[model samples]
Target: MTQQPDTLTESLSLALHYAANGWRVFPLLPGSKRPATPNHRAADCDRTDPWCRTGHAGWEQRATNRPDWITRAWSSNPAYGVGIACGPSRLVVVDLDTHKPGTEIPEPWHRFGITTGADVLDHLAGAHGGTITPTYTVRTVSGGTHLYYTAPDTTRRFTNTAGKIGWLIDTRAHGGYVAAPPTQIGSSSYDVTDDRPPAPLPMFLLDLLSRDQRPTPSTPNDDHNAPQRPSSRPYRPAGCGDPVHSTSAYVEAVIAAETAALNAAPDGGRNLALWVMATNVGKLINRGLITEHAALDRVLAAAAGHIAADAYDTYQAEATIRSGFHRAATKPTTSTRSAA
Candidate 1:
């Protein structure tokens, strides 16, 4: 395997290159995705440094295209990886990750013979009657792909999402970051596979994303063809169904609480709140305690109050729920029944 640079020069050079390309760059910790800069909570900011002179500037705010800043930051730490703030860079990077060892591909995706994030993207593209277009691409150390696209210059700002596009596919846009080429983590390095400038995001993909950001009316189905809740049987207590291998009252209670929280979330933060709730609900699905269809139904019901209140659209909620559930499935967490 190719090793990372032993000195500061290589990192500095790459940082400058990214800046020249107008990407807002920041320093990530050596061998990790976390920011290298000290992130103090706003309440704890003493306003002692230039970064906090006016107010606390987090990684996104501090990310810059300034050559001097990039040089100064990287020069001080040779191992610091470069991070590109996607929002300011006006880039949408589709992250296609490989599956972990010994894990089954999740529903819908596995049913369609999908394996990796790339496969999922290709399948999604085919479903939309299109093919993957050439763009600025990178090969991650883990053998995954990152397809970089230029974000449209409109009011719609895409945010970081897990499985919003499809299984194994995540995106970094507004309020997210990506490790730039030449950044090394342990024995591996992120390398550019394609040097081309980013192509504009495809219209079909844009439409899919736009639907996620808009609000919709409160309804049982988010879209015309969204999967409907199981109507063949009445609701059963947790662990009481034939399909469910096990049961946990704790899981059901968590589902209730999380849904309630999502419903009560304030207008400005409802989307994020919804995503979090969906993710937690997905964890239940991961444990096989609740079926995916049942989980989706609960989330949509909770989000109904918000949709009626004009908080967000149904397509957006559906998109978020699917993404969250798929994320949990792909990255299953260790959960104990007692703690559910």
Candidate 2:
């Protein structure tokens, strides 16, 4: 079923939720009136409004657009290129291309915008192991700073977590633009350096640029129709010649255990049968005997026969098994009298 777009109230509610948690919100405003403004404090915006047209439009064009904008805005930039948007009350970093000019980043290189994430920076610093001196600058964005970095191409991927935020400061490169603070004067510019490119721009970023320059993807089933599954097969990992003996062994053990439990019970409750299977799978996962994905596959395959009638039943059964096992294990076992 198709989901409805969030109402303005819903969007505001979410914006408030992030604000309550101390996230900065950046509102994209169009026109030449202001260089930049904090999003949270910025007045309401409309897609049709001329001021709203300044940032990248690529984001709004995406099938699944995020209200935060940063997520979609940075989708086209270098996977390593990082962007920081500061709202009046929050700040967010994203690893996607900034929207085309008039859509996200206001004008200029907006056409050349790129997306970058946190990992990109980590790779560039060699995680502090390489000789590449990672220099950084903090330019004011509305009320926050856009942390910029100058490193070899080595840090071609952007990486950000709770504590990290920065971007690659490319000097001597045309189309180099920085987001200007609302109050700052003059066009965005950075100083050039003599350091060599640390690493080649990541292939993914290069590919994105090349693809952006090409014709848009062909539409089938009409532009208004929901997306159709592509005829091409989905990508899958290739199998090595060697058998996954460990996986086979785990599956066998689970089957044997379930069979034993089923055979031994005088009155086999569905719960008991489920517990047998789930516990076995959980044990394999805990012991590192099987990958989580493999274990899930096995569980789902086994459930096909037992709880297929009600999918929710299978979910509850699994939850019961996990909780029951943990609770039972935590309590001490009582000694029992044996009959001679």
Leading candidate by TM-score = 1
Q: How well is each residue in 206-250 modelled by candidate 2, as lDDT tens digits? A: 222221111211112233453333312221211323234345432
Q: Please report, in order, the local distance difference test score of every candidate based on alpha carbons.
A: 0.73, 0.32
Instruction: For residues 177-288, write the lDDT of model 1, one tens digit per residue.
Output: 9988777777777888888899998765674465433333344434556444433334333334534433354554465445544544554778877877777678878768
Which 10-residue window of candidate 2 scores lowest in summed lDDT?
331-340
Off by over 4 Å in 2: 1-251, 259-268, 309-312, 324-340
Could you give me the TM-score of model 2 versus the true structure?
0.22
Q: Give the Cα RMSD of candidate 1.
A: 13.4
Query: Ten consecutive residues with minimal summed lDDT in candidate 1?
Result: 331-340
